[model samples]
Target: MMFEKIANKIGKYTVLLISLLIALILYPALEQYKIGHICLTLWSLITMVAIVVSLNENKKTSKRIQLASGVLFLLIGTLLTRQVLGLSQEFLYHLILPFSFLFIAYIIWIILSSIFKRKSLGADELSGAIVSYLLLGIMWGLLYSYIEFISLNSFSFAAAHDIQAKGSALFYYSFVTLTTLGYGDILPISRFARMAAYLEAVTGVMYTAILVAGLVGHVGRHR
Candidate 1:
């Protein structure tokens, strides 16, 4: 049982860590990008295998956490590919908003998960539940950001440069998107991209809502 628990956490975190590094390698939007992309893909597959083994142990909290993280990680993995390519504002102009929202949401999710763990009731079960809830937020935030960024860049990079963007633009856009607050300075120029952005907004709202609901449920019912 203890061995299983340790493996489960290792698997989940491996997925998260590899995905983050892969994003960095892939977001440059430049040529000669194949190596990083392939390595990221391989790591993603390995993470999946680890998650599967961990889940097979079938502990309830582990199952739920793994399930949620697995699904989110898959999406996040796909999105991480974009991080390999978001290189210049010429390219970023198209993907700026999506990338921005994606990064911010991820940061929020990680921080929340960490805090949730720290607030434990001196019990493993409660702490795990809160951490799972937090991962749900993190997973959604990261997954949504990846989708948003790819959609924008793939569809709009050809419209020509609107000026170069710094790497920080992704974080800025991600924060706005994660908070569901859009200022309209950054617009999605294509139908799919627009819808992707909308979905991100919805996802953010739902994640926050779930976190609040989980907190309430834990307090009222778990106690």
Candidate 2:
């Protein structure tokens, strides 16, 4: 049983490490190639599926099935702003693939929170985990959006078309909103885009208030 658990941890971390390496190094290097793009897509799909599967429980499978909803949430979130703004299929190809990878990374964070919850959490751990999760979500969202913007930005755009850069400027924009350090340089181009920005900002506020408070509450009431 010990060996089984250790092996599982190793497998999970190995995939995560590879995902990070590819996202940070390999993808950036070979980003312009068709084969590189295909490899990235395959790597992301594999990583996402592996993460969803990692929630496996020996006794009950349904509890783990909830993990699949993580994948669903990612697809919905990406497709919402993506399709609403009517991005090109070629751009969608690059955007959805990398965004999917980052979303899985976010779900992995959710899994970490679940693990922390199962262990003993003091007020410090509670505060740290809540802040970390919020920061992580915003960070991952930015990365995925940056890739989108990189693929979309063009020189021959009109003023309206130029605003597409703002949509793709997700990494820079999301953080500014999350930290409430709005620079106002990159504005939301469309209603769907504005809605996403609003949701992210609201998420930033509620995350601190709700998750942080819940952690403190649990710690305060502990036996």
Clashing residue pair totals per candidate (backbone < 3 A) = 20, 1
Would you estimate the TM-scores of all the predictions?
Answer: 0.43, 0.51
What is the C-alpha lDDT profile of model 2 across 125-194, one tens digit per residue?
Answer: 4433543554455454554354445544421122443333433345446666776676776666555556
CA lDDT, candidate 1, residue 57: 33
| Runs off by more than 4 Å, candidate 1 | 1-32, 57-176, 179-186
Candidate 1, which ten residues in sequence have the lowest lDDT sum? 158-167
lDDT of 1: 0.48
Instruction: Highest lDDT: give the candidate number.
Output: 2
Model 2 earns a TM-score of 0.51
